[model samples]
Target: MISVEGILFAAALFCCALATAGYLISLLVRRVALAKISTWILAAGFMLLTLNLLVAAVHWTGWSSFGSRHFLSIYAWVIAGIYLGLQLKTKTRLLGAFIAPFILLFLIAAAGQGADRNLVPSQWQGGLTTLHLVLAIAGEALFVLASAAGAMLLIQNNLLKNKKPGPLGRLLPSLGDLDQINHFGLLWGFPLLTLGMIGGAVYAAFVWGGSWPADPKVVWSFAVWVFYGFLLHQRLAIGWKGSRMAVLSCLGLIVFLLSALGIRFCLATVHNFI
Candidate 1:
């Protein structure tokens, strides 16, 4: 018999898939009705995913044994939760076209059947670990939204520049709104990410002997941090905006994601807590 957590997980997966389809249909058809329906469907999916996580936590002693799989699940939950929160604040319903695909990707990743074979030592299972992962994943979720907004801005700008305002372009948020979301993401995400890095470094030094700077994952994380730092500097100091900023934001997100995903598998890293 399927457990309650398993049942909830399956339902959450189905809801996310349907929610993604609803958002995509709304984008292609430019139908306000479909967009509204998609919004509710996504909300339902988010709630179900949340419950699934909660139930799992109850069984596993509340994140004390979290591994790569739990990180992926929490990452997906944060992304979806942030998107829903942004929808309440902004007119970004159409932005779901970009956000939903990521939600689906994360959900699929979370569904992997791998159990935690390398749980951290019991002595290392408290506040710092929780704080580091939570802050880091939350910051990444914001970056994901920022990148999606940037992509929309670029698409909208291209249509305007070429005098080809297609039906899809008509549905996107205004350039100003998209830029605001990007700005919000950067303003908050950078500090959280920095703190997370600091927390991780402290935890590592406390647990292991050194800071593990030679680790490839640490190097990649620093690179990602520097890339976002440069983008923020460009935006605030040089007053970069519109297409240029959009392009950079999207590019930075790709680099951030690649460093997180690709570097983990491609290189030998001590941070592989899987």
Candidate 2:
């Protein structure tokens, strides 16, 4: 007997998959109308997933819930919220073609993981831990989006610099627009990332008694931090822009994903394996 929640989740997954397919098709045809439709459909799917997350939250308690929510629930919503924000603020419909597939995969993975039924915090790590986690995810989300924007910028820059844009190139935003988005994304994402790292440092000291670098999670976090820090330094000191910034963001995104999302897949993080 399938519960109502299960049915809703299935429907949501279906919708997400459909949206991904539609967006992919849009890449070939470049229909603004279809792109808009895909966006709405993706939003509808995300809404259903949000409902599912709330239902799961009602069923769980303790840090277990928080941990599980981090892996299965919170991250996807954060990314979706980011793309939606990008959609609202800019004429970035082209991103839908690339972004939708990623969302579909994330949501599909989320659905498969199911919600953890008892994730309430079991210790007194302080309110700061909760705040830290929230901040950490926010920063990671920003960086991820910035990275995506960076990749787009690079593609657009390369196509333009060569004086011969390809067919797929037609689907991309102008280099100027991509450059602007990368700049803004980094402008906002970097600060949030810095705060996340600081909050994480505090949490680590309180929890592990200064046993910081030993944890793989912390190691990866620092690795990503260093990468982005270097990017920022180059951007400011070297006057890096356009292609250089785009490439840096591309590398930065790769590091961020492997650390924040991929590390969990290895069963190596406190956030639980999804």
Candidate 3:
């Protein structure tokens, strides 16, 4: 028998899948109305996931019971939330065609994990750790959005460049709006990630002392920070935008994913909780 939590998760996943299909169809068929309906469907999935998380938190007796499953779920939730929030300021509804699949993928990954498993050890559970995770996840989620926008920008640029926009071109967002979304992601994400790293560092100092800096996860995270910092600097200072920035954002995300996977599976670090 499936539990209520399970059912809720399943429903949320189903909603996300439907939203993904709706968004794709909207793009292919050039139907703005379908895109609007897909946005509502994605919003429904977000709400259901919120409820599922609340139920899990109550069942586990605290927010500290987060495992890999919960982490992925929250990650997906943040992505959806941020994207929906961006919709208010930008006409990027069709971009949902690119974003919804990622949400679905994360939810699917969450479904594959054991819901009862707690990734954070008892010793590491506290307010600071929770803050660190939340901030870091939000930052990463923004990066995901930035990459998606960048990907769409590339498509839009190519179509415009070739003078072959056709119906598909009409379905995409403006390059300026897509660039602004990328800018928003980098402008906000970098600082949040930096603060999150600071919080983690403080926690680590109290727990692991000097040796924590040498941990593989810490090293990889710092490298990621520096890479993004450079990207941000280039965007603000060097005035990089359009295709160059778009390509870099997408490539940066790819590198981030590869390095993260390598660190998680092949490394021996104290930060393997998630």
Which candidate number has the best lDDT?
Answer: 3
| Residue pairs with backbone atoms closer than 3 Å in model 2 (clashes) | 61-120, 62-119, 62-120, 62-121, 63-119, 63-120, 63-121, 64-119, 65-119, 65-120
Q: After superposition, how far is residue 30 of candidate 2 from its true place, in Å?
A: 3.1
Best by TM-score: 3
Least well predicted 10-residue stretch by lDDT in candidate 1: 113-122
> lDDT tens digits, residues 54-102, model 1?
8878878644456566677788889899889999999789888799889
Clashes of 3: 0
Each candidate's number of clashing pairs is: 0, 10, 0
The candidate 3 region of ten consecutive residues with least summed lDDT is 58-67
Please write out the lDDT profile of model 3 over residues 1-274, one tens digit for every residue: 7989889999999999999999999988899999999999999999999999899888886545677889899999999999999988787899899899989989998989988787888888898998899999899889889999999999999999999998888889989999999999999999998989999999999988777888888898898899899999999999999989999989888888888889889999877755
In model 1, where do residues sit more than 4 Å from their true spots?
62-64, 115-123
| Native-to-model Cα distance after best TM-score fit, residue 209 in candidate 3, in Å | 1.1
CA lDDT of each prediction against the hidden true structure: 0.82, 0.72, 0.90
lDDT of 2 by residue, 1-274 (tens): 6766577677777887888888778877866677788889888887887787677567655566554434545666777778887788788777766666666666677666645444444674457776766677777776767777777777777787888787757777877777777777677767787787787687777777866667777788788878777777777788788888888788877766666666766646554445
Q: After superposition, how far is residue 81 of candidate 3 from its true place, in Å?
A: 0.4
Best-to-worst TM-score order: 3, 1, 2
